[model samples]
Target: MAGPALLLIALLLATLGQAPTARAEPNVHIYAAASLGDALDAAIARYEASHAVNIVPVYAASSTAARQIANGAPAELYFSANERWMTWLGEQGITLSERSDLLHNQLVLIAPRKDDASSVALDKPGELVARLGAGRRLAVGDPAHVPAGIYARQALQSLDEWQTLETRLARADNVRAALALVERGEAPLGIVYKTDARASNRVSELATFPAASHDPINYPLALVGTSPSDAASAFREWLAGEQALAIFQDFGFAAATSDAH
Candidate 1:
């Protein structure tokens, strides 16, 4: 009886010793602009392959993301499509660290892939309106809150065509949404980032907006919490490095220059 009892005890001890231990990887939450979805996903995948951290990303309009963070969202990192929202977060007293411009983008006019019309000259007065025709609308992000829309508005205003097109615009929640409208043929035209147009096969680039027509299109990145975890800090640093910049460029985003705002 003693031999059998000792054998059972040894078996149980061995089973317990060989059991896998449960460990939770550190989680880092990222809130970024919708336009960054693809590029950021690639970056996250690359980072995770070599690290033990779990990354969770939320993509939305910069305004929506910034407002959510101000409302106490659990985002440890915030990447805005423009500096306005980041500055707004600062005004709201959201503690930020390692803030800097991350990338630059160009605004473009796009049409459905099947559209055969010649590229419309933005400088030619009435060209855009004629392109829209009767009852058609130009799809764009909501200029009131979306960074892309604001830039579009600035460009149109610079061209002296805002008043004519303002009421005929189809406002969307984000730049991607605007791109979708044109891709789906729901709107004959759309204004979006060059990267956004490039990502979709359903849309064709019509023209690139003049950079001087709007404020420099800048994407800003920052750590959002009072004290970000070491993993989050490391990820932020990695994103600003040359490897990440190369990845961003592959996705059609230009590197932000030191003098870029």
Candidate 2:
């Protein structure tokens, strides 16, 4: 699979109009993966209105976010699209206690609605690969570095379709980018998170990888070492509260933790 060209765009509101050397707000510094941009914004708004303080969120890939935190990026909270990165932080002793799996997502195939008559179908699992027998383009995140892509690749392997479709694959730097390719009709179909597929009307879901196809897709959230101990605990509690869980469900994510006492 060939990688897409770079097109860096700022998606975070707080990071906009601020240079790297500019003054930063004294609010909680949150380093989140890019995929969470939509969900985090909704969560932050409710949190600030109720809590009376700002929480700055910096969005990037989960791996990139982890690297920044490891290099002292001044992040008080770390929310990753996958748990592996958070597990890495735990290994480095940067995770505070009371870690929680915040959400669960599935990998799915999306295509332009106009292409609906084609071989892609949500109920049929290997149909896309069967249809793209030779060289139709298929977009996906770069499995080498991106967690979503990793899962996408793992799922394809489970279906025994990776090798057959390898030549026609167009790899993007992240899930959003891959979605962009399909939305633009650059590729007939793309592999992206189920939430992302639902987020856009330009594309329709073609198929979903079975939950048993790959490892569990767990999104874990934890307080980083830079946050105040008290505030960190408070934030974690609020995140799992009724308000936050509702927001998560609205954004098409399944709550990973049970509130049952």
Candidate 3:
């Protein structure tokens, strides 16, 4: 899909002035990709403690979140795990010129922590399917809409494993759901973000997908439409500030996007 021609505004809170205080504290509603939950939640807590506003976060597959925003959801900002959905929002004219790529993540293969299976190096062409045996399954997000699933599919195809594993997949709505499938042993293995795997004690990393296998994982945040809320705008800037950057590292995300700073 093509994006609308619009100014990509840069939000600098110090120069922008404080948001007008509402009758009651206004909740800053954010629609985001599910994979952002841990880091974003920590940052929200800190922001709420120092500021009088509360952040309301709705996390789902990036594709799902983008569609929800386009359907008139009351989200003030959108955080997507991949640029495709954010660009989709741009096409809908729902995202303002003020946007920043907030963070980065890596695709990984994980399995139940207690499993006896040896780590399968993804560089080998047929290692993945051979480990699954005749009927065992691998779990992943629904590739039709989930960013993690799309990356997983790309990695598998690059390794020449997709033809063997595609039909055998146990697909889930989002990456975390796919992780749960592996955690519960419903599927012997699963594909998820490196951050997701780190957040879970129930799973262990088996392999990391080479960067060549898929597009870079980027988390982009943008003000939805012409957001007038000072609170929403302030919070958006805070996410890229030092405090949030520390929190992002704690939760397994890389440094903030270079371009946004």
Q: How do the residues 1-261 of candidate 1 rate in per-residue lDDT, one tens digit apiece? A: 999999999999999999999888999999999999999999999999999999999999999999999999999999999898999998999998889998999999999987475687989998888888899999999999999999999999999999999999999999999999998999999999999999999988888999999999999999987889999999999999999998999999999863322
Q: For every model in order, what is the number of clashing pairs? A: 0, 0, 4
TM-scores for candidates 1 onward, in order: 0.93, 0.82, 0.88
Give the distance in Å from residue 93's predicted Cα in candidate 1 to where it truly belongs: 1.3
What does candidate 3's lDDT look like per residue over 1-261, in tens digits?
123323223334533556665578888899999998988999999889999998999999999999998999999999899888888887886756578787999999888997574688787767787766688889999988899999999988888888888999999999989999999988888999999999999998988999889988989888887744999989988887888999999999997555541
Residue 3's lDDT in candidate 3: 32
Tell me which of candidates 1 and 3 scores higher on TM-score.
1
Candidate 3 lDDT (Cα, 0 to 1): 0.87
Model 3 ranges off by over 4 Å: 1-23, 115-117
Clashes of 3: 4
| Superposition error at 126 for model 2 (Å) | 6.3
Looking at candidate 3, the ten consecutive residues that score lowest on lDDT are 1-10
Off by over 4 Å in 2: 1-26, 115-126, 226-229, 258-261
Q: lDDT of all predictions, in order shown? A: 0.93, 0.78, 0.87
The residue pairs that clash in candidate 3, if any, are: 8-97, 9-97, 9-98, 19-230
